[model samples]
Target chain A: MVEIIVCFKHVVDESELKVDRANNKINFEGAKTKISDDDKNAIEEAVRLKEKNGGTVIGLCLGKADARKSVKEALAMGCDKARLLSDPAFQDGDAIRTAYVLSQAIKRIGKYDIIITATGTTDVYSGIVGPALAEFLEIPQATFVSKVALAGDKVTLDRLMEEGVETVECDLPLLIAVAREINQPRFPTLIQIMSAGKKEVVEWKASDLGIEASTVGKNGSLVQVTSTQVPKSARKKILFEGSASESSERLADALLKEGVVN
Target chain B: MRFLVYSEDIDVELELVSAALKSQGSQVSIALVGDEDPKENSKTLSVAGVSSIFQIQDPALKDFLAEPVTSALEQISLEAKPDFVLIGATKRGKEVAPKLAVRLKLGCITDAQNLRFEDGHATADRVVWGGNATSTVSSKSGAVITIAPKANERAAGSSQPDVRVLNFETKTRSSKVVGKKAKDSAEVDIKNAQAVVSAGRGFKKKEDLILLNDLAGILHAAIGASRPLTSDLGWMPESRQVGLSGSTVKPKLYVAVGISGQIQHLTGMRDSKLIVAINNDKNAPIFQECDYGVVGDLYQVVPALTKALRAKTGR
Candidate 1:
């Protein structure tokens, strides 16, 4: 039987984020949180793999304690067990520190066949954690994976790249960072949501995972965010209100005058 | 400052070289991995700002697999000890940088832009929250960062860099490429296109995209689409998708037809020099972000615009 670990992120709902253009800052207060879109795809893929093969799917998350609510959602969708790596020391970790923490937790678990992750989180979109985790754990990784076919311990993956797709093969004990096109995430039934609370959920801290304080959190971050600002551009906001043909002619003339048209 | 730059594509490598050169008194080195002739590759890479070229000639690296490339680069970094490792942020580069960073225990940044050196530290800006805001980050210790493709100017100078070949072990490779399927050649390269006409869900049907095609054909522009047309409706290939998840375009002129202008879509094309939107709803968010907006049906506006442009330009 295969043992799968699906890693997901709890991030600010960027769609609902409010940018104060006047101040050139983002207002994060009162913002909501959810499982990132592509991470949900990772969770769905893990659940599907478990259903296909005789195996168990364990949900893993690294977030604040508030993330437990979202972690329950993973259980509702189908993780047999879950682990939440939440500690005050883990705050403000960059991709490197985050990957290190996850790798340590995986080592503590001591048994896993495949680790699934999103190509990148919707919030940061850095796309570093998966490959970094693979390095920290010393496993092979296939990123941007759109398809997966598992047979015994061998896994075939179709990786989507800018030019095309590459079909690859690797053994288990691998890391696969899935793309959005992999599969559609399913909604949990009401019963499933209710019963999800009964599943095993463990909250582990840095001390529990044997992670030294110097190796995580803002203190250990290699890259520091020195500043942040909203990218501002003043659009002309000119409106051409008329019949389609009239507006079309006017737009063509205006574009030609602007010299943007060749 | 010392910088190590590597990319699978020669052109992007040159751009990274140029970016590194932007910092005065900087020494740039490139690690080239492949079975190809290092002398031939170094001829193109040895620019004015570059100090040396490190070549790891191996057959296993010919296919652009991350495992082997990372291993080779790791080998070079151990010897070079450069303060900054700049990798081309292609699909392969993204995979390679993180693993390399973990191997070296260095911090890593992705999609780094506006790189500058300060007090022996490398600092750069990157887009976050899907282009809503920019974050300026810095790393005092050595770091691995992926440079977005075409993010910087190409390096130009008469100086030549010394080339050193090293033998690297590829025993770490755990996956193998069995086959590859190239995408259709018909798909336009929107990233390189000077003008683009993007479609959105406002189209009634798939065949109706002909209107957008006609407009783009006359303008000599590429065809781009919002995520729905490519990912959900299957009207176009994913390459034609212009959004946070798809290709980002900064063409001189961008025409959005029936697009509602979600932030995800806006993040990709907001950098275009001039933007125009045609939608039936005046309140569509696309109008807020466009330089010029027309409140009318795209079916009528698109064809009429095409006809007007065809007549005006005499194309």
Candidate 2:
């Protein structure tokens, strides 16, 4: 049996973010939050592995209390149980601090054969936490994994890279960061959704894990975000609505005139 | 300031070298990690501005796995004590930066677009919020940062730099490379294509993609897919997928067919020189990001556009 752990995040949907060009601000107020798109693949892969190898899939997340709603969906999608870290001390953490907190939480979980994470998150998209956590745990990691096949205590993975794919083999007690190409995340059926409430959801505060407050959150972070701005789009945004043939002809003519086509 | 840089790719290293040079009076050292002789790579990488090149070689570092690479970089970092550890933001760099930072008990900033030094601190601007916003991040202490791909011009230097070879005791490698497959040359490569015809969920069926292929063939464009067409429907291979998780392309001309222009998709191709979108909904967000937009069904617009291009070229 492979004891699989999948790490995920609750992030505000970036697509819903409204950019304020005049003020150079992003209005994230009331933006909808969900289990980040990439993390869903991690969760799904965990469930699939558990189904094949016969073990438990545990979803681990660190976020604000509001993230619990998203964590429940992880359970619905086949996490046998979940661990939520919603301590105030864990808020506003950089990747290093975030990984520290996650590593500590994973320590509390104790036993796990495999740890899974997405290539990156939707909001921060730093692509850091998984490898950092693996470092903290002193484990090997295969990032950008497209395929995984477990045999006994060894797992073979197809690691996607810019130039090509490399087949990798790692022993048990390894971390794998999956890409979107790895698997199609399943949408939970209504029955699963209804029953998820009955499943175990254990929330942990920073104190619960015996982590120092000074080493966890904003105060503990070495990097500080100074400012953010949305770049103004330079596109001309020319639009043509007409009969299909006419619109097509106009677009083709424009392409030629623009000198993008020979 | 002293800066240390390493990358799996030499081109990205040049970009890091350029970024490091931006800090006035900055001394940049490059770390070459491989089992092969570093003399050739060191010479190729020794731009005039670089102060030194460290050739780090060990049997355990034979492969590009994160564990050994992080361990090797960690050892080099502690010994060199650079003010900034700049890694090229390739797929491997993303994994290694954080691991190295945690090992050094430092913060890590990933995919930094620009790096500047002032008032005894380093600040980096990065695209965050899924490329919807850019955030300027800084560190109170020295940090590890991965430079975004192509973020700076390749460094051009004309000085001979000293090269130092360092060998570490072979550490136990946890992962092994069993096989490798280079991207099939016959596979359609949209990353380097001048033009791309991208499909989206609006594509009704797998066979309907023929319309895009026809259009792409006429325009000498490669085929790309929105996340749905590739991830959900599996209509196309993952390589052809273009989005946050897929290839980030800056083609000269990008024609998005039926893609709704989600922020994730836009981030991948918004930098294209020219963008065209076709969709039935006028209010589709893709319209805002496109240089030219047609508010009509892709089923109709794609075939008609193919016909129009075919007629114009008379091929």
Candidate 3:
């Protein structure tokens, strides 16, 4: 049976959070967290692959202790088993360090045919963790995958690019970063949610993975957030009030006068 | 001081890096990786601010695979030890930067805008929570950074610089490109166009895009759409979708019709010079971000705008 692992992130739901303009900080206090929008598609794709090809789907998550909640959610979404890597040492870990921890967990989890990750996380959206993880695992990887097909031990991917689509082929044990366009993620039903509580969730701390604390978290992060601020727009924001045609005429006149249009 | 700018193609992002490096009084060297001839490629790429060009050619580097490109760049960096490296934040660049950072044991930042050198460290801003907020980050010395496309002004053309061909072999064994296909040409080039007319979910039917297309025609603007219009409804090609998952466009004018201004969509086009939003919902989030907003039915407002533009331009 094909063994597929889907790596996902539990992120602060940005819609529910409020930014404190005074300090330029996002207020996550009392904010709800959920699986990142793109990770949902990753989990759904893994589940679909398992259903079609007769495989076991395992969900992997790396975050704080709160990430245990994600393991249950992934189980509800049809993941057979889930693994969580939680430690205070993982807080604010950059992409490179995060990939290191994930690759280690994957190694501990044993053999796997394929690993899937979202193109990016909703909170950070750097889109670098998957590729970095692939590097750590020393495995082949395809990013921005919009379509996937598996046959035997070969995987075919249609990678999305700026100008065109490139179809790539790689052997099994491949990692793919799926874009949101791949598939519509399914929400779990009440029965699935209730049964998810019974599934196995293996938890691992930094020491359990044999990773040194100095190399796993903020101390290891190379990039530093010196400061943050709301982007100030310099637009004039001139409002034109009139009928549809009249407003259109006025807007056209303003644009022409500004030399934006001839 | 030395700076290295690497881009597979000679594009605005490369030019912007050249300009940025030049302004900082840093000697700039560009690295071009592909099958293109060094002498010929330098002719078009050795614009105003570049002092030298390093052309890296290998059959293995032909595809957009990140591993090979990262390996090649790593080899170059090991020898040159450039103080800074700037990569354009394309799909391939984002995949390669972190891996390169991990390999080189250097800091890396992605999607940096308004980058400047401060106290020997590279500082820049990036949007978070889609586009609702921005964060300013500074990287340690010897950091690899990916500059967002259209983030800076393009450098003016100047005399060609000297070209130096580099001997490097790509050692990528895992991934292989099977085939490649170009998107349809009828799709608008939002990246390069000066103006764009974008559609959103407010577009009830595929045929309604005609109104947007007509407006685009009058303004000679490219037609772009929000994600739902392209990915969900299939009303338009994916190439023209504007969002975090789609094309990031920075046109002189961006006219959004029926788009509710989701953060994902805003991140792609928020940098536009002038934004005009026409939506029936007065309380739509787009109104908060747009420079000019018209709260009315797109069916009526778009046609009127098209007519007004035609009357003024005599097109």
Candidate 4:
């Protein structure tokens, strides 16, 4: 049986977020959070592989204390067991620190054939965590994977690149960062959602993982946020309000005047 | 002060970093990593403010597997100990930068559009929340940063620089590339197109893309799409998708049809010189960001716009 660990993050839904123009900060008050969008696909892929190959699917998440809900959500989606690493010290941890903490938790879990993660998070979207985590685990990583096939002890993946697709082959004990195009995630049924409460969720503090407090959170972060501001629009927003034909004529005229077209 | 810039090829990003370093009175050296010979590229790089070049070659590097590349760069950084390490924020760079940062135990900044030195640290500004916000960040010490493509103008210099070949041994890794295939639609280079005609979920069917194709033909533009049209419906090739996971384009003119302007899609095209959106939904988010917006069905609006453009240009 194959044992796989999938990692996800709980992120504030950006569509519901409001920016404070005067202070240049994001207003997350009263905002609803969800499992980061792409992580759903990661969890779904893990569950599907378990169904086919008959293995255990472990859900792992590292975030603030509020992220326990994300572990429940993952359980409802078919994760056999879930683990959460929550601490106040992790509040300001950046990608590098988060990857280190997650790698430590994976190590504590003991046995796993593969680690799956989303390509990037929804809010920050830096797309660096999985690769960095692979480094910490001393495992080979295949990122932006669009397709996956299991063959005995090796896994083959079709990786999406900027130019085209490349087929890559790697052995077990590998990490894969899957793109959103890889699979359609499943929605939990009402029964599954209810039963998710019965499943056990193990919560561990940063210290419980044997990581020193100074090396697992903001204190270990290398980068610092200096300031944040709304980007200014550089173009004049001109709307051509009318019938399709009328608007099309006006748009063409504007483009002509600007010499964007002949 | 000294700065190190590395890329698979000698591109505009190297010149941009070189110029920034030169303006700061810092020495700049470049490391070009790939299978290609550096003799010809050295000529152009030398004139772009590079004082020396290190050509690191290995057959395994041709595919840019993260393990070997990161190992090679780690070895190079150990010796150079540059004040900063800059890499182009391409697909490969995004994967390599973080691993290298972990190996070197340095702070890493990805997708940096602007960089500055302040208070004994390297500060970088990058877009967040798609393109809605920009965050400026700084590291406590020397950092690994990936420069956003086309973030600055290419620099020019007069002197020819010396080139050195570095023979670093690459460690063996488990992953290997078995095959490679060019996308069928690889010829449509949306990244460099002057004008782009893009479609969205408002496209009712795959065949409906013909209307967008016709409009692109009239405008001499490339055809692009929102994620669904490519990833979900396969109406267009993956190469034509424009979003956070797809290609980021900065064309001179971008005409969006039926795109509701999700933050992900906006990040890919919001930097265009001019934006025109045509959608039936008046409340679509695209209306707010576009220079010109028409609240009408793309089925009707796109053909009318195409005809209008043809008549105006007598094409």
Q: Which run of 10 residues does model 1 chain A get worst, by summed lDDT?
A: A225-234
Listed in order, the DockQ scores are 0.72, 0.71, 0.67, 0.74
- Candidate 4 root-mean-square deviation in Å: 2.0
- Show pairs that collide, candidate 2: B48-B157, B48-B159
Task: Give model 2's docking category.
Answer: medium
lDDT of 1 by residue, A193-212 (tens): 99999999999999999999
Q: Per-residue lDDT for B54-158 in model 2, tens only? A: 778776777767877887787777667888899988888888999888888877888776578886578888877866788889988888999877778899866
Interface RMSD of each: 2.2, 2.1, 1.9, 1.6
lDDT of 2 by residue, A167-204 (tens): 99999999999988898799999999999999999999
DockQ, candidate 3, vs. native dimer: 0.67
* Winner on lDDT (1 vs 4): 1
- Candidate 3 lDDT, tens digit per residue, B1-315? 567787665675465556456546787777778755556666777677787777788877877578888888887776667777888887888888888888888788888877888667888788877566788877767678888766666665765676767777757667788898987664447878999989999888998788777888878899899999989889888888998888888889999999998888998888898999988888676887888888888888888988988888999
The 10-residue segment of model 4 chain B with minimum total lDDT is: B14-23
Worst 10 residues of 3 chain B by lDDT: B14-23
Report chain B TM per candidate: 0.91, 0.92, 0.88, 0.90
Model with the higher DockQ, candidate 3 or 4:
4
Question: How many clashing residue pairs appear in each of the predictions shown?
Answer: 0, 2, 0, 0
Residue lDDT tens for model 4, B173-228: 75999999876663258887999889998989988788887788877899899998
